[model samples]
Target: MMLRVTDQTMTMSAQRSLAASQARLAAAQAAASSGQRIGRPSDDPVGAGESLRVRAQIAAASQHQRNIDDGTAWLTTLDSALGSATGFLRQVRDLAVQGGNGSLNQNGRDALATQIDSLRKDLLGAANTRYLGRNIFAGSSDAPAAFTDGAPPTYSGTPGDTVQRRISPEQTVRVDGDGAAVFGTGADSVFGILDAISADLRNGVDPTGRLQALDAAMNRVVAGRVDAGARLSGLQRAGTENMTERNALEQRRSGIEDLDLGKAVLDLQVQQTNYQAALAITAKVLQPSLTDFLR
Candidate 1:
């Protein structure tokens, strides 16, 4: 059976074919220009889903890297403060020993007492050290100073919680140290020890008790430095790991989301050629009017 062909049918068919060709060309051009294989979910559902997941992972890794940077700064500042505290404690300990010497006269002991008094204030200053307007030793307390002035300096800041920073999906690190634990409050503290030593020197009394206290305080400072040093080292290691993971994620995301310009351009050229050929064919195959049919 022969199927009768009509001008209207031919024209309609040509239009549909042209529209489809144009759609293909548009899609190829979009891929070429946007630099992405997956523009919309409809393009390739599975590919688009994979791209979304990879992009999300990239973003998360980038955020974790930022957290690691911030954590590094916090730990650096805290460690520096602890270092200063260690120096101050050591200096005061030496002065206490000199004051305890039997041959030292009252006036000599008084001079040593003056130096020790100055060292105590310096230690207090170290105790109340602030970084970015926040006390380094004050834990999470945002107080300006960690210690207050007195015979035994008072710790006004709370025993704040340790600040932890996320460096990866599965890892977090302690960025802030406990201040109350390092420099104890009031009479039993480093400051208190210094006070007793100064008072004993002025009164011509031996500084044996003060010397013992000073040794214990110095040990505490040493322990604090050790802990801070360990944390700093861990932060360094975490930072290195984060960088490695970030690079890996970037490569993965690029494989899924990034466009292959060379291939896209070739595809675009082929699509353009096909569309042009369709136009030429449609002009010849579709009749413009019934005049052509009668001829």
Candidate 2:
């Protein structure tokens, strides 16, 4: 009876040891297959919390990258509008130079005047540039056109309307530019000068001062175009910087979040070897049963 009782105790101890070994092997297998130690909070609460924080950071960085791209696209639209506007102003300037020649008879001047009118209409259309259903030059009004049709193209919006674009954490850049500065105001406006010239031409009046006014308007437009170009350059620089930083951050985040395939494969192989050894040991230990002892 004493010998049988001792044997039973030994068997139970061996069974418990084998069960622990099997549990460890299962854990190693799961870790190798999943490639993550903490599947849930129940697996490792502290590690899960860290993973959540890292993931949130990565998401925020990705969103910031998208913001940078959107800002750049908007700036590109603005640049395109400015380029077209520059060309329109150049047409007006050419007309001004042509009209300045006194050798032109009344009929010649009238023809040139008509050409200027066509170009002015084109300029007005250009001023109302829109991208994605939003007016780029309307000073945040979202108006269909920056200027309304009349004797002189009149502004229907306020001045100095601006918008901010966030390029980075704690860093914001201004994207919107005031329309009045570029278009001119009151008597000095391109539309105003063009209107005066058109009226003088209709009255059969010599538009000597009107030609000079066009020259002045041309200068303003050129200067404004240059300013717009500078702003676009700045936008490009800022966008490039933001992209570089964001990409670097993404790389860093990947280092933390993404599995190292080389290291992971090595670890998996090691775990497989360890698990197989444990299995072999367990199989040997588990071979003895009550039936074997009875036999």
Candidate 3:
């Protein structure tokens, strides 16, 4: 039996073909205008998923960079306080040496003792240094100062607790120094050491023997500063690594989601031509009859 070809069948087929061509051309135009291959998840599900993952990584890297900046500020403040404390201790040591001189009379010793007391107060001030209203040496404690004022200053910081900042996914750094460890506590503290030297000087007693204690205190301050310097160096290195990671993540995201403008423009032109050709062919194939023209 011979199969009859209907005009209705041909018209439906042509319509479907033209619709597909128009859809492709619209997609190409969107890609060219938006400059993004994956406008939505439906465009490329796998690439969209990968792009989301890369974007999450970029957000985390940005947060870590902020942490690095805050940590650097805290450490910088702590280091500066330690530096000041070291200088104060050095001056105290020099005064102690002068007070130990055999030729120095009572009046001379009294003057040296007064200077030592003044320096002790300055050192106390350094110990109580704050950054953004937070005590940098207080080890996470919300104390107003690292040490309390008294006959022998006591450590106000919480023991075994410290302030820390996460600079990366796997690494964290201590941003606050330990006041008790660096400045000692009670009678064993640098304040107490200064007090003793001042008392010995006022009593006509040589303070050269206490030089050992003063030297030990200065050493602790130096060590604290060294640790701060090391942490600062590590933060600098982490910042560099973070920048490199951000650049790589951006490139990955571009590969997953972004389109090459030149390629997209070319594709749009090709799709436009194909759609125009399809329309011409469909018009020729689906010619209207006299009955259709009357309707």
Best by TM-score: 3
Deviating ranges (above 4 Å) for candidate 1: 290-295
Q: How many backbone clashes does candidate 3 have?
A: 0
lDDT of 2 by residue, 154-237 (tens): 776678776666766776655554557777766678888877776666566666666666777667666766765676676677
Model 1, range 1-295, lDDT digits (tens) per residue? 9999887788888899999999999999989899988888887898888878888887998898888888888878878878888887777777778888899999999999899888888888878877677777777776667888887988876665766789888888877766677777667888888888889999999887767777888888778878878988987888798788879978887897778999999999999999999999998887476686776
lDDT of 3: 0.92
Candidate 2 Cα lDDT to native:
0.69
Provide the lowest-lDDT 10-residue window in model 1: 286-295
For candidate 2, the TM-score is 0.80
The C-alpha RMSD in Å for every predicted model, in order, reads 2.4, 3.8, 1.9
Predicted model with the maximum lDDT: 3
Q: Taking the candidates one at a time, how many backbone clashes does each contain?
A: 0, 0, 0
Sorting all predicted structures by lDDT, with the top scorer first, yields 3, 1, 2
Runs in model 3 deviating more than 4 A are: none
